[model samples]
Target: MSLARRHREYIQSLTAASAPAMDGGLAPAAAFDAAAGHAPSPAGTISTAAHTINLRLQHDLRRLKEIRSVANKIAVKQELIGEYDAWVAGLLEAGRTAPRGTLAPTGADEVLPTIMVWAIDTGDWRYALALAGHVLRHDVALPARYQRDAATLIVEEVAEAALRAQAANNAFPLDVLEQVEALVDGVDMHDEVRAKLLKAIGTELARGVDAADAGDARRLASAAIDRLTAAQTLHDRVGVKTQIKGLEKALAALPAPEPTDPNTTAAPPQT
Candidate 1:
């Protein structure tokens, strides 16, 4: 069978398997809590669904651990993207069962953040950013091994991906980079990482300066300079000095705007 067809079937199977856990067909979280000598969660908090999801998370994480190399992990991520989508969808559906404010953190959840990374790895920017909104809202802790907060991870990973794509002359979506910037605005992260993001945005903007008409070239180049300058100020080693010079030169070479004819009479207003 073709890979796409197989992938669809896999997603369907995963959704079918996860429906029971989402619907509370699995063992109650209270039973596991009591057995482990942990205090029970408050009533209607959906601990049963949380516990079921956690069990699935543990299973997936174990499988990930067995992959020995980066390439292998990437391949596995492609295979599992469908599964992650189902899990995320199930969580969103299950969350509706409880009041928004009443929903408590179930401690560190590796699933959502892991899925975020995997989504990025597989070039699923839309999916990754959607999850970023939820993860940041809840202040979900990333896995211990990540050693970075969600905002930092999101910025750095997406920035690095954009840079790589640019290097290869591939068209990385500027909107995706802009969305990442807006999503993580005001969140604390290393200056270096932030600079990387700015550089990516600046470079992407600079790409179109050459092909643009005089007006557009000036505007794009100016914006590119602003971003690149901010990046340089944040981290001198961000390595955008050459790009800045090139854009500035281009902007300077653009034809000057025609002088406004202030003496010309204004056209009559249309009905």
Candidate 2:
């Protein structure tokens, strides 16, 4: 199904569900409407109706979680990255819409693992970066290990793509570079993949050193310095310096700052 269609159906199922009439006996029409919160009435048991809705929501979310592997493959084959994004987004919406009291941390909660697996297995960095950012931004707390592992996979996959492109002496695609840079900005790092990530980031930055757009030099230098600093922390600076030096030279060539008017002195330190 198209992601949008599937999503509409999912939403329909969620919003349209009503608690089974107590013990299979039908609830009074007015009571039922009131219980479902479709109307205000004094006779309905709102608490019972709410619990029923939460249970149904929990069930559907679990089902979605179960089907995630299938969804993952479908997403990749059809280039349905947006669907994957929507599915995760839907999970969040479900939490608020139906309101589960205590979600087990396993179902939609752990979908990032599968998404990260797809990214690494298919060597799809774009999808991987989206998953990384989604998890980092998510209001639901994923397990610490999943967070760590997702970061590792995101870096490794980006570096893998960057290195492959580098082998041909071609720049990494700008989109890929930007996504990886965003991941680096948000995800926590592990030393195991630190140098690899730095290499990719630094190489992309270094490309600006000789760019026709001379304006890119300082930007590249600033970017590289940031990564180089992180690499130093990881104790994984194997290939960082060369890129840093190259970027430093590019910054050196930037036109000297416009003469600051002695009249335009730096703003006094903010109070």
Candidate 3:
């Protein structure tokens, strides 16, 4: 049977069971009279049953609201995933057409130069310099078939330029430093080319030390130390002993700046 018809039949059975009993050989009016004083009439009983069904219907409506809330959240999540998929497709397309090894160019070049002209633009300098460094490093990783020596030189030049720009603007140096370290680590250079890259790194480190601001000096020094350590580890792992010596020599040549004292008393109180 249909669900609604079955429900109606069930309700009819319950109503029949709850009906007031008749007296012996009684007419409908007599039955009503007999039950009137002690038992509810059919109309009152049916009204109570209807009220109960209404209460259950109201409860079902509340549950429906909760279900709808969960469904709305799922719909929103699906939309977000769709948007992300579209964005990834666009990025892959751009990467396909980009100059071999170069990533998408930034819109901030002119803005960065303008900000650099204004000495008070502290926030923009660090963000712009880091962004520029990221783009340049991507260029070094282009998939074009090139000789190892040429690629190594190109990476080293880009790294040095990025480091210099970061130093110039008193920018947070970590991003540029990490990029340079990656270039050094990933480049497959022969002995002569590796030595040249190491020399370039040494020059960059020296410039960083000489030009680093008071706030950034410690961070730059720490990053330089880490980069040198990483380069040594990479060399050992790759069995490239030729570059390891040059990297070691570069590490040794870096000046050890004196440690800053955190607590120094300059004033004496007289009684």
Residue-level lDDT of model 2, residues 134-174, one tens digit each, is 55444335345445455566667677778778868877766
> What local lDDT does model 3 show for residue 32?
24
Model 3 TM-score relative to the real fold: 0.25
- TM-score of every prediction relative to native: 0.76, 0.51, 0.25
The predicted structure with the larger TM-score, 1 or 3, is: 1
Q: What is the C-alpha lDDT of each candidate?
A: 0.73, 0.54, 0.38
Model 3 lDDT at residue 137: 41
Clashes of each: 0, 0, 1
* Alpha carbon deviation, residue 39, candidate 3 (Å): 88
Best by lDDT: 1
Best by TM-score: 1
Model 3 ranges off by over 4 Å: 1-153, 159-177, 183-187, 208-271
- Cα lDDT of candidate 2 equals 0.54
Where does model 2 exceed 4 Å of error? 1-112, 119-126, 136-148, 174-188, 213-215, 253-255, 262-271
In candidate 1, the residue pairs with backbone N, CA or C atoms under 3 Å apart (3 or more residues apart, or in different chains) clash, namely none
lDDT of 3 by residue, 193-254 (tens): 44433433533553465456644555544444544444445344422244335544544556
